[model samples]
Target: MVQLNLVKVLLLSNERTGDVRYEIFSKEGENPDYPEKIIVYREGNIGEHGERG
Candidate 1:
């Protein structure tokens, strides 16, 4: 068995037409078969600034 520690997660964020998109990926060389670790989060009109959702 083997475990690859999540040393760091690179966050990529973008906002377009009031829509926010986020992508998460592990640092390079920290893990193999990285395509299996890609995560994407999406949201639309989450808030009106200074708000938490």
Candidate 2:
């Protein structure tokens, strides 16, 4: 039997807009399909600072 565990870390943060960024890492290189690290973004706003509808 084999087990896999993933770790997530906060890469970036924004206080004003409640935006966040995260990174996923495979410490043991468990999965061949994925690299050592993966990036993810969680946006609080629809557009960037200047862009608006």
C-alpha lDDT (0 to 100) for residue 29 of candidate 2:
44
Q: Give the Cα lDDT of each candidate.
A: 0.46, 0.59
CA error at residue 8 for candidate 1, angstroms: 0.9
TM-score for candidate 1, residues paired by index: 0.30
lDDT of 1: 0.46
lDDT of 2 at 51: 44
Candidate 1, pairs of clashing residues: none
Q: After superposition, how far is residue 41 of candidate 2 from its true place, in Å?
A: 1.2
Tens digits of lDDT, candidate 2, 1-53: 44444566665656556556766766464763464667777665556664422
Query: How far does residue 10 in candidate 1 sit from its true spot (Å)?
Result: 0.9
lDDT of 1 at 50: 31
Q: Per-residue lDDT of 1-53 in model 1, one digit per residue for the tens?
A: 43434443554444544333434444555654453354545544557773434
Residue 22, model 2: Cα distance from true site in angstroms = 1.6
lDDT of 1 at 26: 48
